[model samples]
Target: MQDEDFLRRPAAPQPYSLTPAILYLSSDAVHATHKLLQRAGRNESCVFWYGERHGDNASVHSIRAPVQRSRRGNYHVEPESMSEMVRDLRAAWRPLAQIHSHPGVEVEHSRYDDAMVSSRRILSIVFPYYGRPIANWPSDIGVHEWQLNYWHMLSSADAMARVRLREFADVEVRDFR
Candidate 1:
């Protein structure tokens, strides 16, 4: 399979809904971090993150980093800023993954994103298409999956792809075989 196949998944025909409980019930710090990453994305209408990863057993809470942008409504983060974030993460004994959002933007991973993630785990959260009815984590060149409207995670490594969605409640898992 091609690299694109590694990031692609079948899309559902409808939108899924995520309940608050589902978002609050994660036992994995990584999973909780992902949820907090989502809120930080929506909170700033831009992007936010912990600047570092967390300890395996630490609770994913009270971690946030605000991104700076120009007055022209353009977002920008410098190399110095990233270095500082990593420094802070090191101080807090956290992981090296950075989470941020692409609010009101459909652009895929850009050169800048590549540059940032090149040295760390970069998680990009693209917000609502505003009114666009596209699938969650939808992309013509990437992965797309359904979670009964809760969460979607797409990954591609070594031409191997995995797409999985976690539901907000108990739901049937369809077997297409």
Candidate 2:
């Protein structure tokens, strides 16, 4: 029920690194996506820490903008926003990996979603929230299970960084964990 619980829970420890300025997701990282989705609805952005090596230093990456409520009744990150995101990532010299929500259901990429994801030379993270209660959750920590799925891209180290810079403009870094 709290972020502390997540921190203390016995789950696979995904390797990560935190900068005084940003958090990083190392390769082999995994965690719950459900909580993230819920937070996104509140217009809060989240990032992932990815490292190239299995348990090496990871970087914090965030998602910008809101997930559009689709006309077909699904949530989606708008293409225009995605384009801007890619541009921003290129500017930052990071790869594209977006964190989005699935409120209370299974989060999986649709065919359309895949098509969009495939167009980029980055990673895609589909976080699905299963409607767990976190009212008593800590502001700094959270826990959930994330299934591993990815697209292969030749990189210097088999990893990429997807950062959400918009968060820095709105909230303090402490609010992100």
Candidate 3:
């Protein structure tokens, strides 16, 4: 579709619920995601993750979708690559969520994004990669959970706060020096 498809805002707030209770992200995983989005600039970039979800905690361990140049754009993921990535990741780790960057500051899900979530009920995170990367992330991120009909965008503070809650207390972030 149009280049700004992903940038558009939704018409109305849709019903949604946070799934898996807790999400634990590794430092390396966050770093790699930031780097990929930065390199892509205004264009959209994404990464998938494989993790273990037990009761209320989901421990994300590794990145399943690597940066592939074949589908570099501001609004879409290459169909072929996406298909292959999902297939490959499903074989090993459960596809927990899809992380992407927005060219603009708006972090809400667009209509296109809602349509994309048609059949899959997964978590979707939109990062506002506007300025310099910072050490803190809870203050500048968008978290959305797919419900039966629509995606719900959680408040940035709430999302971060939830992640920092006791459920994700034992996460380990590996330092790549």
Candidate 4:
């Protein structure tokens, strides 16, 4: 499927929004993410950094946590591993977001996700797997951000507008792989 196909997919009944506004990702990062999620099968999880946050825009850099086996529909990051990743990334770049895949499910934040969000300002992305081929991975990418004591799910258009409200209307998704 094409990139536009992702937007055309039906929206889930959850809130999603890009907290700061804009988000950027490298083609390499996107490709690797697809591969990682595919290898993870359904319900498995992987974690990554949204790179450095610059004002209302951020870039997705690399995978901090590789795909790991877990129970159906659940994946947990070890506390120690998470702390180490945060420490290492914070030395140079802050952890801006975390991306995970929902195998055979729509992209939405589960209660588990909300509970795990902690108090940090981070963008949580859910990629729809739905048992589709890897080429069709991320068929629908859900973007969510915690704000006003809730996780708001923003449509693609809304996300773009939010990111562009204060800056230029033209938002670019550059691949610096």
Candidate 5:
């Protein structure tokens, strides 16, 4: 929705603005993420996006696959593993989103997913079919953000706008699995 429309709403204005947050990702980063997740086969997998955020826009330059336990249904990343994954990363790079894979088409957040996410401030994206390409990346995929008391899943259109995929070089992928 436009800024004017958002302001015209009847309810009390939210503490946060409705201005959409944009995540800039390169095609290389997207491919690396899929490869990392697809390695888990029928199990769930996760890769964290770390990058530079300026205002409401961020550019994902690194994809880290932390050492985590994975199963057919879920995955878990330990605190120590997370610490190790980013030990050498630059201080300025921030966690942009947590991307994971689901075995099936269902990409909604489970209760476990809600609790396991490293940060509510970042986006939680779930890729379907064990990270295989599913009806174009980021569209059918689950892209949720923390809103109010829950993780609100954005619509396909919103998801596409929120994550802009571009052709670029120099997307680094770190696999600590």
Candidate 6:
């Protein structure tokens, strides 16, 4: 094989087919995620949404916060930490999204975030104001998905169609603080 062919990037991501097209989240899930991120104050923190998927629809049934090192602008979760956090979760559960906090309203994923995301097959949602979340649900929040070769932030209209926050839904919360 030519050097160019050998050096070429891996095949384009498989379109994340295993992920649901529309994910329904419970208000409690949002509340729990915000609460965990807020505890870090000015530092950025992260959590994960894990659940089951049925066809194009999925419901978030669990929230998990890995033991991560948070800074004002970035956070890091060791692979081992992530594994330990999810080890006890239901065997059938799959991670739907990784929810993180930013210091400002710039919800766009940073270069660091793009590289640090746990999985290309899952969504990545970023909240502003260190997760205090001044704006309404989904508003000002950055919902990102991996497509082609990049992480694309969904527009408001797209976000609405993709993720819905219900007033009430059952969600189990686990934090590795």
Best by lDDT: 5
Best by TM-score: 5
lDDT of 5 at 83: 94
lDDT of 1 at 162: 29
Each model's total of backbone clashes: 7, 24, 0, 7, 0, 0
Q: Of models 1 and 2, which has the larger TM-score?
A: 2
Instruction: Please list the Cα RMSD from the true structure of every candidate, rounded to 1 decimal place.
Output: 13.9, 12.2, 5.0, 8.7, 8.2, 7.0
Question: Candidate 5 — which residues are off by over 4 angstroms?
Answer: 1-18
Candidate 4: misplaced stretches above 4 Å? Answer: 1-20, 66-69, 130-139, 160-177
TM-score on alpha carbons, each prediction:
0.35, 0.37, 0.72, 0.68, 0.87, 0.86
**Lowest summed lDDT window (length 10), candidate 1:** 168-177
Ranking by TM-score: 5, 6, 3, 4, 2, 1
173 in model 1: Cα distance from truth in Å? 35
As for TM-score, the candidate ahead, 4 or 6, is: 6
Q: What is the lDDT of candidate 3?
A: 0.58
Predicted candidate 5 versus true structure: per-residue lDDT over 1-177, tens digit per residue = 111112221322243234468999997888888899999988888999999999989999889999998888778888999999999888889999999988778777776676778898899999998998766777779887877767666777788888889777767889998
Which model is ahead, 2 or 3, in terms of TM-score? 3
The true-structure Cα RMSD of candidate 3 reads: 5.0
Q: For candidate 3, lDDT tens digit of each residue in 109-129?
A: 776666654236457877775
Candidate 1 residue spans exceeding 4 A from truth: 1-48, 51-59, 70-74, 83-92, 103-107, 129-177
Over 28-97, each residue of candidate 2 has an lDDT whose tens digit, in order, gives 2222333444544533233432222223322443333333433212444555654543443323334334
Specify the poorest-scoring 10-residue window by lDDT in model 3.
168-177
51-73, model 4: which lDDT tens digit per residue? 66777776665455532444446
Error of 2 at 128 (Å): 1.9
Stronger candidate by TM-score (1 vs 6): 6
User: With candidate 1 superimposed using the best TM-score fit, by how many Å does residue 65's alpha carbon deviate from the native?
Assistant: 2.3
